[model samples]
Target: MKKYALATLISPFLFFLFTNCNKDKSNTEETPVKDTIVVKIDSVEKKPITTIDTVDYNQRMIALSNNDTTGRWPVKAPYPLPGALLPYNRIIAFYGNLYSKRMGVLGEYPKAEMIEKLQEEVAKWQAADSSVTTIPALHYIAVSAQAAPGKANRHNMRMPFKQIDTLLSWAKPINALVFLDIQVGHSTVKEEVSQLEDYLALPNVHLGIDPEFSMKNGEIPGKKIGTMSADDINDAIDILVRIVREKKLAPKILVVHRFTQGMLTNYKAIKTTPEVQIVMDMDGFGSQVLKRSTYLRYIYKEPVQFTGFKLFYKNDNWNDWKMYTPEQLLEFTPKPSYIQFQ
Candidate 1:
């Protein structure tokens, strides 16, 4: 009688415990994680991404590093890109604004010889397989202050609109790239870049930011210029990319000169504009005390193209241009993109 009574009393407790367990499970909430998807603003669809496609930026890097059949670095773009300009290479040259002038007598190599020389360089590049190819030399025209005194000093600073036209005429036939360097003024970044809208319209034309003359707010360049702010540079490059895209021009390169970190105070703001190239030119003018070390440090730390070099033509060494040739410049662990001769 006692055992039966105990069992009857515990039945209510057991039933309550079972009811509480079911209630707890019913109240619980759970949700599975969704995969990351890029919503193409236009399509508004969720496209699945494979693991390799989503994560292997490194693989893409390896492919780009590998040389093409011509032993040249191919850019991430449509193949057979116009001009034999290697997408990535150690040395892209700097041709003078009026490098090939058919001055005085009839003609030696015809004004087109400079173009021919560029072609020859490309031929040499094609001979090698997966070897380091040299990018075609680039000619930069300085229109503002903070220009290099000896190399692109005040005297030779501005390339008149007419001279620029001649260069474009020659460049088009050979498919050469040109950079129009500018020193920021009191005007905003957009305002300054706006001035060169016509030039920027061309496929080969691009902009270069010379920190040497980039001014602080209200300060004049060349005299007491201040460091460039990150936002100012970022906005400038962003606008340049938009222009290139809307115009259907080749990918424009935004070149920034930096000898030290202070030169570009806000580097993080530099955005990766689609199809636009970002090159950080380490323009160390003086003797290369740390040229090798700095090139290794900076190039590895930031994978941007490195440029600029001083030659005998430099104000300090113009008389000795012959002493240091292109071969000598290539001695750097990774060669320079271009050498700036005075």
Candidate 2:
């Protein structure tokens, strides 16, 4: 959200209420960089990675809760079918759209520089908590909400398949995961997710839906904060379930971003299936206090299956304010399982 960076000039109270909206025009003319090379990991024979330890699942879950006595930290949800990632590995993702540098770190730096930065973050998180492994990820905004209505009269633009292919390539060399984030505007979640069936079928590819730009009431995106009902979230879960089952693939991770209470309604009704793991991400940028308050108010209080936190390099570091370090974030009531950088 561009407005997040302007908080210093405005009232702190008012700034906290504004949604992070990206209204930049989609740059479709740029072609994928075929020569881009991600860092190569050492080629040594290693034990096959286990997504979860069945016998110690509960123990791992408790460890992830970070001694939360609130009873809401380790959500009482069904154990995801084998090959799940949550509660086992903390995902460190860089979020943004390749078309807009202002969107996030994903597009702000050069491919090589961005990957290097993400690797450094992964290492920091690993060092902060050695209990859980850290997995680097690229959270790309595949479907972006637009300021202008397109041919479909929906204020959303879907990036071409080639762009997604490029992101997949970037993940290969580093052994990282990929998350395709969607920001629907004047469109439905089902409509947007259905279009990505091909990509979601892949084991390494996951999903993220942003209710901040949902625009369910037909309001133009970026003018106001939007919302997504439990049904909207369930729609996404349903799609991922079908993909996992039909393809006989591992469970997929679904991330939903929220900074305010209204952004996601009927939280209790959001279903968690064995084929899909849901992460309720606190997607806001501000002082460390404000960010923690927002997480507690919405994510921690709501009792989602898993939790995620986003860091804004420029927004959180504004006016002499420092961003939250991985060690500090680990002190959170229920340590975030997913960490995103914008």
Candidate 3:
């Protein structure tokens, strides 16, 4: 099984791809350029044409990290996982609170309009790589935040069952998967995960743990960022693993969103099992260069089962620059497999 890193960029496909990273060196090989071109006859032209190979992302990154001719710093390939989920795959997801129009596409647009927006994005990704399948998902932030705070006054709030059920119903009609994300404000992963057991039992449902609001100490979620140790992540993994085994369902996907180093602690200790797939998503929104830098610093630097990228519909589009298209994102050595739009 090969461990993979996930990279995702803005709205259109919420696309991300999988690639491996190896931090420690056990073997060495000659480095290769970021991209290699090959000539092939176009079906329509009947003439040989040169095209860049996008599928060799894993190999290209390995070459850059392990073998470098320049005296610059050399990067190391991420550790390989026993197995990964993407074979040049992509996932386009609409993320936000279904209840608040300010949150994401889910609530920003009417149901009909939102569905249309998602479908349009799907079409774009399919056009980019017809061979790969694009999964449409409703990335509902089940638990959101509030200023007044409740019960624990942790600022971490849970979405009502009614709201989640409504979104699940919408996803079902489109044959989309439902991702229930938890902020866990002033709460523990164990506690948060345990409450969602019933929903996790569903075959199409998945999980996402956001460390940004984890509040490792006693800091407020909005006041400052938080962190999650490998242990915290493992607890969520264990819960999903058990659910998958007991239900005899397909492997469950768990996405952990991150952008900064402190958002996630202890990368090496994080483990993946047969029952559950883990994706380390770079959840920051910025310009193309800034986004790429974050990917290199975290997703590539710290190897995980897979990588993911998040695109802010408005935030990423700042500075009058448009969002990154699927074709442009494929330029990365290891393409991101999971993508989310907010």
Q: Model 3, stretches more than 4 Å misplaced?
A: 1-85
Candidate 2, TM-score vs. the true structure?
0.87
Q: For candidate 1, what is the total of clashing residue pairs?
A: 6
* Each prediction's TM-score versus the true structure: 0.57, 0.87, 0.75
Give a tens-digit lDDT track for model 2, residues 158-215.
Answer: 8777778889888888888989988888889999898888788777889999988889
Q: Rank by TM-score, highest first.
A: 2, 3, 1
TM-score of 1: 0.57
**Ten-residue segment with the worst summed lDDT in candidate 2?**
7-16
Off by over 4 Å in 2: 1-53
Q: Residues 1-342, candidate 3, lDDT per residue (tens digit)? A: 111134423322111110012112111211123122121111111121233243464554443233434322122323222222343346788887654566667778999999989888877888876755676888987765333345456555666566667777788767677889988867789987877777777766789988877877777565566689999999998998888779765567798988777778887788667677777788866678868987878776777666677777887787776778888876654566788887
lDDT of 2: 0.79
Candidate with best TM-score: 2
What's the candidate order when arranged by decreasing lDDT?
2, 3, 1
RMSD of each: 27.8, 5.3, 15.3
lDDT per residue, candidate 1, 120-144, as tens digits?
A: 6545544432344444444553443
lDDT of each: 0.45, 0.79, 0.66
Error of 1 at 177 (Å): 1.1
